[model samples]
Target: MAATAPSQSAPLAALSSTATELDVRDMVEALGAALTDAGIDGDLRGSITLAVSEALNNVTEHGYAGRAPGEVHMVVDLLADRVLVTLSDSGHGMPGGALPPGLLPDSSGARADLPEGGFGWFLIHKLCLDLSHTRHAGRNTLRMTFPRYLAPEKS
Candidate 1:
């Protein structure tokens, strides 16, 4: 699906906080609530939550590496047919100052020897219909959109 802007006058949710695990969790929960309020449910909601969590976890782990955590912001907008999420932080830009290629990791080895991580960008790329990143003036911004897999609201 094409990345479309929200038709509504306001975003479904927005949050800002110091880049920390707890703060990330809270912000993601807030997004989940907003999605629920917008009548999104089932796997789409879970996919959005997971993608946002991975993005936020990246901020906590890599963005703030070797220094005090900085501020992070998340804005969620519900379009008629998709959801847009923008996450920004005043920390390190992506390695090499660009978004990763998001190549899937090698998983052909033994289960015990598989990589413990390195799937964040890959999953984000897979889940989002569109994704982009930018770095300017000591800040990084990631924008992504996911198709609304919309399930009917249960009575």
Candidate 2:
């Protein structure tokens, strides 16, 4: 039997998995495939993948305290003028004043400390058209968006 496409009106595709490094890679791959199928391309695909990976890694490393395994949920939505991705984790909330910086450097020169924790956040902000983070009901939700102009060209 052929696979069925998700409903257009639904506006989201979601999956939940235990917090694991391998699982995160798999999730990113799956999400990337879905986004590509939806016509997301150019730098947009790379941006989405990077942002999602960083967000998920944050959940595994900081949110879960790198000990107890928790659930990470990801949702992707296809809009007329943009693609939106939301990743949620059932782990500890972000620390006070732990938000990412507003500006990011275009070159590696701006990133002097490669071993630090700021690169992921910088990449997410630099790649996505918009990004938002929220903590609610004991979960952290990171939402990312890509504009239509950046989407992949249909074959």
Candidate 2 residue 125 Cα shift, in angstroms, is: 0.8
Q: lDDT by residue for model 1 over 20-115, one digit each (tens)?
A: 999889988988888889888788898889888999999999999999999999988777677889999988888887888877799999999898
Candidate 2 scores a C-alpha RMSD against the true structure in Å of: 5.7
Clashes of 2: 1
lDDT of 2 by residue, 105-125 (tens): 445555574444457777777
TM-score (C-alpha, index-matched) for candidate 1:
0.88
List per-candidate RMSD values in Å. 5.8, 5.7
Clashes of each: 0, 1
Error of 1 at 59 (Å): 0.5
